[model samples]
Target chain A: MTSNASGRKNLTFISRRSPYGSGYAKACLDMVLSAAVFDQHVTLVFMDDGVLQLQPNQQAGDIHAKDLSAALAALPLYDVDNVYADRDSLTRRGMFSDQLAIEVRLCDADKIAEIIRQSDVVFTL
Target chain B: MTTLHTVNKHSLNSDLLTSCLRVARGGDCILLIEDGIYNVRTLEDLAARQGCELSGLQCCVLHDDLTARGLAEKDLPDFISAVDQAGFVALACAHRQSVHWF
Candidate 1:
């Protein structure tokens, strides 16, 4: 279903902020998921402290809400694959993909540039 | 061939400015929306020094946001254009895609 111009839109959602403290993260994730439901190709790139959202066993029990980590894990079932994490950001935070519950492709700085270039639409939160 | 980059946050920690600089192409335009209007001066200086071709790429600030923040056009770089919500929508439609940086 890939067309050069109009078949499907390529959307990249970049999350560089914390997931729990604010509504921005949740809103962004919701938007991306909705876009995916419409059959758009979606890519999620987590940078900086955004990687915290992917940490295994996130217990938001204290927050009195559905776990965000659980929602993020359901992305693949919705056909919203291509999750990525910036290598520098992960290393800077002393984390690795294995430490996360969701599988994420490690991307270097150059790859980050490529992601932006390839995306038809990008949202940063 | 037009591409619109929408910057919506004010903090340097947001890294939106860096992202804007990274993906900005020759003919693409940058729009400072929401809290992003504050970046016009810094971006203009960088654009000039980097010799980045911005004449073909319009730089705009949302007038509504500026007013709400108690900022004026004179406070921004002279090259930056100010637009309203209708103009913002027109800009997004004119561009092939829009990138939001927060």
Candidate 2:
């Protein structure tokens, strides 16, 4: 699945579950970081209940859960900056783009479809 | 490149199918396995309720999973076809990549 001169593939990760509900969110994050370490072009799309992971002021410690926001904040450092969130998902939950803890490019259904079509590999978790 | 999007959850238990259908393109294929086979009878209704267009998409249900779930090929909508294990493998070979949505 290698593409481009540098051998980077268009890797897309779609996170659709709520953080802390299970290990899926954390595992997905770990996989993304790992892919970035390999110099792959990683794109993360947060949709469905996954949009809730971007909510600010999360006190995950009270629930004995790791701080996902802290991990999410490290995305830019890893150069995995192609972050997106489904517009419909955010609106359905009454969340606004400005309210998220991190900056994410909001994508409509059609844009998301295009993203998938362009991906060389897609991981949905 | 075409993608095979596989969903493994029942419609009522999770919105994985809806989420998968949202981004699935025209040439992409959707395979329902595990509890996802439970959606055989209501896939069209669910898609309609979510405003998802399935006109150009190829929908399939795993035959083994359908049999295990006590469903028959006749239960599937005309838009969907039953694929055996070999057919599933053929689909994987035909598609550029496969995404599993649970």
Candidate 3:
């Protein structure tokens, strides 16, 4: 068994689902954020419907809850700055870079596959 | 590389199983936890008839979950291995990456 003594581990969180509708997305985000708090190098990739999460100007008021948009705003402060988005997904959804609050790297399908192949750990929500 | 899948939903509609199967590579393993255990037979059958090679792939179920669901090892297909928490960690360590399917 190889020891994880290298100290630096690449952890990627794949959020394929939307945010806030189910506990899955929120829980996954919380865990990744917690891992980042411990100084782990965390990468959060939003794909498919998960891209809806990074949409700007969202209000959860109708659902009677605090807006999750605020949580994403703090990601950089936690040093989890590697936030990515699927380029095809955005195009299919008719969304543009101006629609997002966070600056995301728009990757194609092939790039998304490459990212998953290289990650030390991937959590899908 | 081995991939550990943490499945929490039992419904067939859950894309957890399909997504995992699609990305699984040779020498990789899959563990069915929570409600994910139910997909063992489904996956095996698909692999057999559809020519989908789960090459060097092993399926595992969480023993605690099976017990809680009143299911026994014998109740599951022969392809599934009942594992404990330690086994879960061992599988995770064996795999290059881990994905949680909820």
lDDT by residue (tens digit), candidate 2, A55-122: 88889999988899889989999998899999999999999999998889999878877778788888
Error of 2 at B13 (Å): 2.0
User: Which of the two candidates, 1 or 3, achieves a greater DockQ against the reference?
Assistant: 1
lDDT of 3 by residue, B9-92 (tens): 553766566555655655667777878766765777656654546756777889998778878888888767899999998988
> Tens digits of per-residue lDDT for model 1 on B1-102?
456888887545466766566557766778998878767657866666656656767889999998788888788777788898999999989877787775
Residue-wise C-alpha lDDT for candidate 3, range A28-78, written one tens digit per residue: 679889989876778888876788888888788878866676787888888
How many collisions between residues are there in candidate 2?
A: 0
C-alpha lDDT (0 to 100) for residue B65 of candidate 3: 86
List pairs with backbone clashes in candidate 2. none
Stretches of candidate 3 above 4 Å error? A1-6, A22-39, A47-49, A62-64, A70-79, A86-101, A106-125, B44-53, B63-89
Off by over 4 Å in 1: A1-7, A108-113, B44-57, B67-75, B84-87
**Using TM-score as the measure, which candidate wins?**
2
**lDDT (Cα, tens digit) per residue for candidate 1, span A39-124:** 89888988877877887887788778668888998899988878888877778778877788688889865576567667777787
Off by over 4 Å in 2: none
